[model samples]
Target: MTSATRPYGTRERRRSIGSQGESRGGGEERTGPAASEGQEATAILERARAAVDPELRAAVDSLPRRMRRVARYHFGWEHADGTPAAENAGKAIRPALVLAAATALGGPAARAAAVRAAAAVELVHNFTLLHDDVMDRDTTRRHRATAWTVFGDADAILAGDALQARALGMLAEDPHPAAAAAAARLAACVVELCEGQGTDTALEKRAPAEVTLDEVLVMAEAKTGALIGCACAVGALYAGAAPEDVDALDAFGREAGLAFQLIDDVIGIWGDPGHTGKPAGADLAARKKSLPVAAALASGTPAAGELAELYARPHVPEDPDDLDRTALAVERAGGRAWAQDQAADRMSRAMDELARAIPDPESAGGLLSLAEFVTRRST
Candidate 1:
C-alpha cells in the first residue's frame, strides 16, 4: 500500500502518535518520519477545527429542527437521543486545507478571513459522507453507528441534502469579496463528486474483469479529489490569489486527494480494524471495486485469476479464511505495490503543483504536512 496518511477523521485514535514516538533506544526519544508527520498534521487539524467549528455549528443550527437533529448526530456533536455527546466530529482535513492554502498565499490575516469559507467546505464534505453512508450501506463511521442506522435512511438522506444547501447558503451570505467565487467552485465540485460516486456504483455492479484501472482512477478522482481540490481552490480564492495560483493549488489538492484514496483502499483491506473503524475485508465483502482490487483484477498474474474467483461471490465475514486468501491474492498479483507506487507518483505531482504556486518550502509547510499525512506509509 502507499505510504500516505489520513486527512479527514476525528475518530478516536486507538493509539496515539506519541506512543509510536516513544523511546526506542537511548533515553532520548525519537519520532519516526511517519510519526512526525502525524504529529504535525494533527496540530494543523486541531487548529483548523478550532477556527472553523463555530461557523460550522452556526450553519447547522440554522437548519430545520429535524434536519438539525440528524446533522448533529452525524457530526458526533450529539447522541441519537439529542443529548449532548462530545464525540469527535472529524479531523477537519478539508478545512485545514482551506486555511493552509489561504495562509500559504495570504498569511495569517487571510487565514482568519477564510474561516467561513473553510466551514462551508467542511460542511460539504460531511454532506458527502452522509450521502455516501446511505448509498454504501455503511454501518460504522467515525467509530460509531452511521446516521442512517440511528436516524433512518430518509432522515439521513434529507439531512445530507440540508447540509449541502446550508453549505452553499453559508457562502452566499458571507460578506467576503471572494465568497461568490468560492461558492461557484464548491458547487461544481459537488457535481463532480456525484458523477464520480455514480460511476463507482456502476463499476461495482459489473463483473470484476469488466473494470479497468484508468476508469477506476478517474472515478476515484471525481468522487474524492474534486472536493479536496475545491477546498484548496476555495481557500486560494479567499486569499485573493492570482488565477494561475488558484489553479495550481487546485491541481495540488486533486493529486493529493487521489493519493489519499489509494491509501484508503489499501487500509480498507489490510489495516487494523481498531485503527480504521471499518472491519478488515469489509470492502471485499461488499464487492466494492476499489482501486487495488481493480488493479489486481486487471493484472495478468495467476493470483489475479484467484482473486477474481474469490470475488465472484461476496466473502462472508464468517469466512475469514476466504477473505484472507483474497487479500493475499491481491498482494501477490502486485495490486498493493501498484497502488502504493501510484500514490507516491500522484503526491510527487501534487508537490510540483504546490511548488509552482508557493516556491518556499517553509511557506508550504502546513500543506506539505497535510499531504505527507495523507501519504503515510501504512503499507
Candidate 2:
C-alpha cells in the first residue's frame, strides 16, 4: 500500500501534521525513545491517585466478596502468577483527566465533587473490560487471566454488572445537580459503548477490506472516545465551570480519546510483549478489523492482496513467522505510517482543544503535558 491508497479527507489533513515517518525497529521498547516522559507521566499519575479520597477507598473496599475479588484481581492488586504482589494498577488516565480538567477550570474545592465522579468513571471502565474479556474470549487482562477465565463467565458477567451499578450508585450518592448530570452522561456513554462494541464484533465476521476508515473512526469514537470525553466534562461540571468551558473540555477529551485508541491499536499490532502483556500482532491473528489492518485492506494494494490470501487460509494459531509476514504486509500497504500520522494529528487536535478550553497557562500547561504523555506513551 502507498499514500495514494489512503482515504484521509481534507479535514483530517488540515488538523494534523502527521507523524515524522520514522519506523520503529523490532524489539525496541515502545516508549524507549520517550523514557523520561513516560517516567514523568507515571510519577504524576501515582501522586494523583495517592491523594484519592479515603472515602473512595472505603467505597471500593465495601464491594461484595465476588465483585471486590474480581476488581482486586483486575487492578493488579494480586499477582498474575497467582501469588501476592502489589503491582502497579492502570495508569488511571480517565480519572486523571477528570481531576486535571477540574483543577484547570477552578480551584480544587470547586472540583471536590469530581473526586467521586472520577472514581465512578474508573469503575465503569473496569466493568466494561470485564465484560469485554468474556465477549472476546480473552484469557488475560493487564497480564493476568481475565475474570471470566479464572471464574466462570456467569460470575464475571455478574461482577461487571455489579461494578456498573456501583458506578451509578456512587454518582447518585451526592444529591448535587452536578452529580446528576455526571450520572446521566456516564449512562449515555455506556449505552453508546454497547452499540459500538456490537458493531465492532459484527465487523469481525465480515471482510476487513470492506470496512472504511470513516466507519472505524466512528466505532473508535463511540466505544473509546465517549467515556474519555465524559470523564473530562464530568470533571468540568463538578468544578462548576462555565457551560462553554465544559463543551470545550469535551472536545479536547474526544480528540485525546481518539489518539488514545489509535495508539492502543498500534500496540495491539506491534507492541512488545513485556509492556503490553500480549503477543505482537495479536489483532492480526485474531482477524480483528483494527485501524491499520482496515486501512491496509481497503487500500487494495499488493500488501492488501497478501492479507486477503492469509485471511482465506485455514484458521490456525499464528506463529512468529506468520506474525512477521503480517506486520510486513501492513507496512508495505502503508498502514503503519498512516496510523502513526493519524495518532500524531489527533494528539495535536487534542492539545488545541485543551488550549481553547482552559486558557490559564499554568493549569493548561499540565493538561498539555498530559496530552504529550498520552501521545508519547508506549504501553
Tell me the TM-score of each prediction against the true structure: 0.91, 0.87
Worst 10 residues of 1 by lDDT: 13-22
lDDT of 1 by residue, 26-76 (tens): 323135555676688888988999999999999999999999999999889
Q: In angstroms, give how far residue 78 of model 1 lies from its true place.
A: 0.6
Q: Which candidate is the best by lDDT?
A: 1
What's the true lDDT of residue 250 in model 2? 86
Candidate 1 lDDT (Cα, whole model)?
0.84
Worst 10 residues of 2 by lDDT: 1-10
Per-residue lDDT of model 2, residues 1-379, tens digit only? 1122222132343322223123345333244534554566677576557655354455656788766676667777755344556765677888877877887886677556577888888888888998888998889777777878887798789878988898899889877679988898899989988887887877777776567878988889888888888888888898887888888888888887887777777778887667667777778788777888877777768888997777666336635588778878888888777787787767666666676667555776545556566755555
Each candidate's clash count: 12, 2
* Candidate 1 lDDT for residue 53: 93
Best by TM-score: 1
Off by over 4 Å in 1: 1-30, 377-379
